[model samples]
Target: MDIGTSVITPSESAEDTLPSMFWGLDPIYGVFAKLYIKDILELKKSQPVPGVFFYKTHPITKVDILGTIVQKRERERFFSFGVDDGTGVISCLWWKKQRAMENVRLASSPFGLNVLEQLNRINQLENSNSQLELGDVVQVRGRLRDYRDQREINSTSVSKVVDPVFTAQIARMLELPYLYRNFYDKTFQIQMDSSDPNQQGEPTLSLQRKIKQFLTQNGVKNFYQQELEAIDSLVCIAEQNCVSLCLHHPSQTSQDPPSSACVSKQIHELFQQAVCALQEEGIIFQKVAAHTELYLVTDAEKELHKVTRKIVQDDSTRPKYVDKGCPFHHIVSCVRHSYSAGVSEAAVQRVLDRLECDSEIVSTMDRHYTVS
Candidate 1:
């Protein structure tokens, strides 16, 4: 039965009168008198209560949330962004797998032109089913939330847009062959020395030493573009300047394809590894002001290596897919090879959940063939 809608039969009441919220004649006392009993408790408190439905497990007061940006960190694969209604704020997490959504743009510019752009986008969002973004002023409907680390939380409804703007800086790399080809081509050109077949068609001993020396001296280590972006994000965040880093994954590359879930997991795992590595080296990460950016200090390279090691460890645990490659391989290519592949957010969440539960291997267990 629904908490609020559950009918209390006459036999259940002592006097055959409906329970009233008024005092004196019919007084409501404690959590038992509320229409929704389960909606009023906390998780820590809910653990001790037996037979309580998940819905009634925690009941929080609804508060107004206004003027807040919904943000998800690059390293934290959690898809939801938190927003505030005038009364309270809640975190809204997305679960869809295939759709690619960007946050609504909020204009930071003072010029009327930029403001007009935001206004136009806001109007479009009013009719669209798209999610809110960086510069949206929306009214959220949910209960006030509290967590161990957080004092206030909310589970919000997606409704009522007030002001909308896009206030994010995304790095978009355009592959203009006329402009970037020279720089791009040099990275992949043949540095290997080899002499053309002699006119006589005889093996030339004279070219062997030069070729060997060239091969030994020059080498290339390919890196995924996303990995490079991840590293750049860390550095940018470490500087304590940017809110988030966004990169455009090139479509022309023939490298590995990335699943949505795996990419998110790799970023988060890498972040955790980076934090751990920093702690080992005496570097520390401490929270600054509320809802503000995070800071990383001391040796950046060491922290990066910590993130790298975590990525490597995570890569080893991912299962191989039949159509696309294994999630781990995709991640490895991103982190180690600097390649970018398109991945859905849902796929990323699946990978993160697997990592959290340590059940990725179970997916492969079902695929094993029985010997005859």
Candidate 2:
């Protein structure tokens, strides 16, 4: 059956009203050789709504897949690659100029050296129909499409896999049936009631409360968005709080948890939603630095801490006077006078250590300092 005819473009009503099942990250189904792709191709396509389509089996549109690029072919307007994940090989194509520019931008970033190298390799490859060389592992996120009786992916992103072992581990976890079974079970469901007065007034209040409680209870006054979104980090926090995550079959409960791929996806979605809800309510706030979101609690104490930290960090980088060098006490005094919060000597010392480690400051004789 033709799968393209059954594809659903999300409606405006669905986009605006449909509550996300989990918070921080939107759910993207995983695909490998043995799973959904093979089954989806075998199903009969049926259009259920004006823009949406279904099949005999559930239709999965957006997906995350990993494979090694065995062949690459570039045309005048598009680039295509064949990705094989042992179980199956799929064709992936990137068609838009904007997408190409985004790839370039990502490659230009400081942490994108590997990406740059990959791009360079692509450039160096001869017109022998290779944009990427054979055996280059990659992770793809895209919409699945079928054209002329062939299944292919219209890629949104195609990233070079920096850590193949870690990617393999994730792929293995996603292949487990128990993950999907647990996900469908009611035990993992987020409680939401349309009938309750509080829920009616503010539908996301309970979710916000849970997120706030999780942050506060964990003593996470400040954290990077990635740190909070990381599966291992979240699992560590959950373990510390004696919270149980239902990521496995109901019958087989174990203290040593399985890979957190499934649990992380759910938690990430919930965390994302809760953070957005809290931000909208002005309960918490985020600041972007070095292209990463840093969340901070919006309380007086935490606000003061932020100010103090900034003051010390800033002072450490400032050029020292020629006549009198910048000393540790000088930083404390400046911070104390700059803000009513009264910066402590310990805070200044801590900042010094951080700056020194970062190579932003150099310590001289007699406890004096100069910016490096």
Candidate 3:
């Protein structure tokens, strides 16, 4: 069944294919394809899906990118940075959870805490960010959006990278070529059974779609990539259920469900692919801005968003938040108290970043946020 060894299946004629078919059912559509900014800027818009861009045969709706902030302009709601990835430069818009204007408004009363306390708080908050300075590197994972005839990254989450040795940026730089040559540029071997995704389609695609639907519908707050105990362990749950069904009901084989036919490693990789795909679409996130393991449903995490927002809203520029907005540590403590002890600082941080990116919360400083 794994006959797809080449880019284009020779049997398929040109007349049999359409661009939308590539956009609709291909697994690449779900991926936030990693490509050079030059390629991204050069890719023509997909005729079938106006929002999507095409890199040769690849259909790209989103991207997971790393670039340097070569130029920047801070706006009321977002920060506009000109990001250069060596290949090209593109405008990257990172919307804030807290605005600079709000900071000016909240910090109106400059005579509050001792100078040391203020400095300490500022340092503590700023420890999480490199002050988003020019020349500093940032990782932007979001959709490819064009505004005013200019291509830009409408980032879902933007975080400053602490790569003193440039390890992460370098690794991505080395990895992209292999991915492009082997995966992105290659044409998929079409399934002759059903070209349309709407009709009964590939089981793996089906499962991914189902999980995405589940996250979207339930507004699932959080999940784990490897932890089985996680409440919203989509990958783990599917794997457990599938393997269990195979053992319990010997008659129920993987052929009936292509997703189950693979080995444990394959299933894990596939599910992880699903998770990554969801990440590309902004349906699920990798984790907190500072942390990297927990995965969250983007549409989900609402209640947590509310909890973090309230901490800033009720106490902005007050004693707990001082005039600077709620400090990161205070916000963490509040989240643990209001949400659940089970939530970690990383998770809270993720929630804060999520809320901020959505403009549900605002932070004028590095780690502090004032809810708007």
Candidate 4:
């Protein structure tokens, strides 16, 4: 056997020495073996020694491919090139010197790069192949060289080549706007320069509030337009309280007492006090369902009969009406049955205790009632 091909054996150590970091610094043999565009920026201060860069080529493999093109020109070219393996993609370029290699010439025509090109024939090849439809995946091997003129490192030359299977599904991933949002991971962000705190030029609190309110109103309107259609039935519309309540008769929807006296009398006696309690705490009762025709039927009807009958019967003390339905109603119903039997003061504690009851009826009750 040739001396060079003789049995492999460990040689005696002549001197202890650290292995060259060159392999560790190899572009294809990254220490971590994978990185993001932002992560590569961290290595700016300590870049690996210049050498060949071999990676799968795709749009995302190259950092700022489109941005670089856009910055150079007003718009990006039809295609952007990238290179990577399962590990990660690195942006690449082909310089004039490195592109002269014979291997670089082969990839030119298949990729539609012109052979007569003067700059880098290899670049022409890569560019020709780089015009991939959205989801095509490819593997490329090349050199990572520093462009002294450009003050940046980029891949050069052309070596191994493998075209990944192309699929239309990859087109979705090419959505530029969506990718930008994901890359930033923020719905919206803004920057403001600091100004002198003592300066009279600062915006006032009232001005800020007005601006915020305007923004909020517009945002709410836009949000409603997008989402309201799906929930129109569940949604209730209202204008500022300019409308009068018209209570509908429970037994007969067509006919309502013209006086509005009976309804008002019962409702006032029952819920007036409780309603006042809620109002004192700053809970504003707003009208619900600006144009709803159906109104609620309160227990005031029963309570009134009992009270008036007791008065005639000479009962000494009038027992308060506590056993009644919960005092919530559709606006129309509340107005129609204006007289409601509210929880009596004597039985207020019991009523409060039962408030926690999870009756399905009460749970589904109209949320449009006026609260005390």
Q: Rate the local accuracy (lDDT) of all candidates.
A: 0.33, 0.51, 0.66, 0.29
- In the range 58-111, model 3's lDDT, one tens digit per residue, is 567888878888998877777788888998998887775542432342333476
How many clashes in candidate 2?
Answer: 9
- lDDT for 316 in candidate 4 is 16
Estimate, for each residue in 252-303, the C-alpha lDDT of model 4 and write its tens digit: 2445433445444433322333223332221212122111221111111234
TM-score to true structure, per model: 0.19, 0.32, 0.42, 0.19
Per-residue accuracy of model 1 over 1-372 as CA lDDT, tens digit each: 112213333233222222222112211111221111112332222223222212221221343334356564322332456554233444554333332234555657665467656656665664353455675654444443445544333433445455333211100011122222332122211111132222111111222222223223433122222332355534343222111111112332335444444446434544444443433333333223111234333223233334334553544445533322234334434433431122222223333333445532322221121111
**Residue 13's lDDT in candidate 4:** 15
Worst window of 10 by summed lDDT in candidate 4: 234-243
Residues 1-372 of candidate 2 have per-residue lDDT tens digits of 111112223332222222332221222223322234444344333333221212222334555667788878878878888887665778889773523424456525666467766766665542223346778877777766677767777887777766745645354444434334423121211234433333221323444565567677776677665665564644454432222333233433586564566455545555565567666554555443222556665542444445545654566566554422465566667656764333335445555565667776666534455656
Error of 1 at 111 (Å): 51
What shift in Å separates residue 242 of candidate 4 from its native position after superposition? 93
Per-candidate clashes, comma-separated: 38, 9, 7, 20
Better of 1 and 3 by lDDT: 3
Among these predictions, the greatest TM-score belongs to 3
